[model samples]
Target chain A: MKNDILTVMWKERKGLFRIRGRRAQALLGMFSPVLLAIFFPLQEGVEWVQSPLSLLLAFVAPLILVGMSIPDSFAGERERHTLPTLLASRLSDRAILFGKMITSVAFGWGVTLVLLAIGLVTVNIAHWDGHILFYKPSILLADLAFSFLVAMLTAGAGVLFSLRAATAQEAQQTLMAVLLIPPMILQFGLFAIMGSDSGKARLQEVLGALSFEQIILVIVAVLLVLDVVLLMAAMSRFKRARLILD
Target chain B: MPSGIIFGFLGPNGAGKTTTINLLLGLLEPTSGRAEVLGLDTRTQPDEVRTRTGALLEHSGVYEQLSAEDNLEFYGRIWRMPATERQARIKELLSHMGVWERRKERVGTWSKGMKQKLALARAMLHRPPLVFLDEPTAGLDVMAAAAVRDDLEALAGREGVTVFLTTHNMAEAERLCSQVAVIREGKLVAIGDPDDLRARSGGPRLEIVGRGFDENALGLLRARPEITAAEVHGDHLVIDLRQETDTAPLVSLMVSAGVQVEEVRRGKASLEEVFLTLMEEER
Candidate 1:
């Protein structure tokens, strides 16, 4: 089983950037993350490393990257007419599922880490006041754990949508729409609440009751639960007979 | 169904050929009956069954963005073949298929025929004892189709592997398959060797190239109790005879009736005719 998963990963790695026009899209996609890595540090100085501003990059980078990848990993096989052959091979279901999930998470998380590092370097160089600037220990931990969890969330959701999608582009479009909904609603809800004086005071009071560490832990726990639930759903949906019919 | 021979599965569009292949490969489970490939029950031991067989399904299933060698290498790893052995086998199969020189070229850039050839090589990479090919040469031009057929025949012969081939091309089946089964509307309509099906569907036929095939000769030939049907096309006369009817009497009767007989050829129905006849019967 381990070898089977590794074999699938090997294939996914080879074909990662080989999808038609995908390399160009990837380079184009990198532009924003690269900009964020450089721009935010220059604008915010040491505050970029010391505050939660970098967490935005950490969350959004993996979500977007994994959103772009997991669909292609899953739906691209069906669109290209390669999934049946892969399923017809000696590989088991879990092997294929885990292999694709691992590759997508790795790609998304790996790129986010690189961008975070680039942000760190930018801060140290631009703000050469004294010692090298680095992300605070708490922020660093959140960036790593949060980015990873987000990648998993996207991958898990991507598989479910990809199974029903006729093409990779369709899967990506649907997945992006679905993923953006929760965050969009949250942002609007925050805005609506902050618009009122009572809501603002009540919100601050609730937040003030908890330490920063407890809040971070709460967010991490919620994400962790969603990740497992989505993963389980993906596994249940990844049956050989079902995929062949699809 | 036998070892060391090509078994042709013939059917028209939507005739469940692809479904049967899927069931046999254990990619889809049968709703009613069970099947076994290499002594492993398809429903119970699909992995073991798949591990020992190869399949070229409805689509070629090659990664167009990858080179021919990489395509084979990926499946090779899926089968868990050792690196050195897999490399040697890929080279051997590609060379046999006459695509070894272009192994590094991306498959998407190649013509459809070339891609089909590469797909065939991928199916045979593991040297399995049996392979299921669903319409392997379905949409190729005449020359390309013949080339693929030739490669399939050679490889099957040299390796002594059993091939379960599905095709709509009757001439291809006549040339390659030792046994064939024809299905219609999810039911087996006919199953036998090509000759056996031909004989069952039709009778002896005689064609004589001649002039002076007038109505008199035609009526006389048709009136014979042993003859089933008689027709003429310009200088040629065709006669379908009852089983075991001697051609000498028919030729003499034609000659005496003033029909000039140039050449006589004896044959049975071709596989195409047999297939059509079976389909007509089902309808």
Candidate 2:
């Protein structure tokens, strides 16, 4: 099973990097991340690593990156007419699913970490801090865990959308729309919460009651359950016969 | 049923040929029946069956973005062929297809024929005991189709692997298949040697290219008990005779009827004619 997963990953990586126009798209995708990694740290100095805003970067990085990649990975295979052959191969359902998911997650999370690390170096070199600048252990842990969870969430959702989509572009667009819904709902919920004095008082009381660590833990826990549910849904929907018919 | 023979699966469009191949390859479940490949039940042990069998599906299923070598390398890994063996096999297959020098070029850049050769190489890379090829020459030009056919023939001959080949080209089936099965609407209509089908698909046929075949000659030819069908097709008189009937008597009768017979030919029905007749019967 491990070997099979690796084999799928090998193909995924080759396809991601070596495909004709995809190479250009990938390089272009990296441009924004590289710019952020360098410019943000130089501008903010050690505060870039010290603040919780770095966690926001980490979270958004994976959301964007994984959202972009997972659709291309799953829907792209079907669009290119390669999915049937892959399905007809000896690889098990779990192996192919996990292999593709892992590749996208790894790419998103790996690049996020690299960007954060580069940010650290840029802070140290350009800002000329007397001592080394790095993320606090708690902040770093939150970044890794949250970013990974978000990446998994995006990938899981991407698979579901890709399964039904006719083309990779359509899958990507639909997934992006789905991803925006959560934030939109959150915005509406926050507005409702702050609409009245009683609601604002309750919100403040809840926030005041929990420490940042406790809040982060709660968010991560919710994300973990959502990730598992979405992943399971994607797995159950991935039927070979259905895919072939499509 | 035998190993090391190229079996041709012949059928018209929408005849469930692809569906049957999918079931045999364990990509789909049968509604009421079962299929086995390489001694493994496709329903219960699909992975095992797939592990031992290779398929080039209806589409080439080649990654157009990857080079020809990388495409084979990818499938070779899927079959878990080791690095050394995979490299050697890729080289061998590409060389045999006469595309070894262009292995590094992207498949999309190559002509349709070249991509098909590479796809065939990928299908045979793991050296499975059996392979399924679905219309390997479906969309190629005349020269390209002929080239692919040559490669398919050579590889099938040299590898000694069981091949389940589905093709619309009866000529290809006639040329390469040891046994052929004709299916229509998800059911097997006829399965036998091509020659046996041709023989059983009515009987011996005779064509007389002549200018003097009139209604009297046609009526007389059709009225005979031994002649099943006699019709003027363009400038020739085509007659379908009952099995084992001699043509000499028919020729004598036509001459007596004042029909000018410029040339006489006795032949078995071609595979295409048999296929059309079966479809007509089914309809």
Best by lDDT: 1
TM-score of each: 0.97, 0.96
Q: What CAPRI-style quality would you assign to candidate 2?
A: medium
- Model 2 C-alpha lDDT per residue in residues A1-246, reported as the tens digit of each score: 999889889888877766557667677767777777788888887788877767767877788888778887767888888888888888999999999999999999998898888888888899884777778888999988998999999999998998878888899899999899998999999999999999999999999999888998999999999999999999999988899889
Runs in model 1 lying further than 4 Å from the true structure: B233-235
Q: What tens digits encode model 2's per-residue C-alpha lDDT throughout B1-283?
A: 6899999999989999899989998888988878878888989988888889888998888998888988999888888888999999999999999989989998889998888888888888888889999999999999999998898888888988899999989999999999999999988999999899999996899989988889999999999998899989887998998877778999999999998789999998899999999999999
Scored against the true structure, residue A183 in model 2 reaches a CA lDDT of: 89
Cα lDDT of model 1 by residue, B153-246, tens digit: 9999999999999999999999999999999989999999999998888878899998999889899988988888898878878788888677
Q: Name the 10 consecutive residues with the lowest summed lDDT in model 2 chain B.
A: B31-40
Q: What is the TM-score (0 to 1) of candidate 1?
A: 0.97
Model 1 chain B poorest ten-residue lDDT run: B237-246
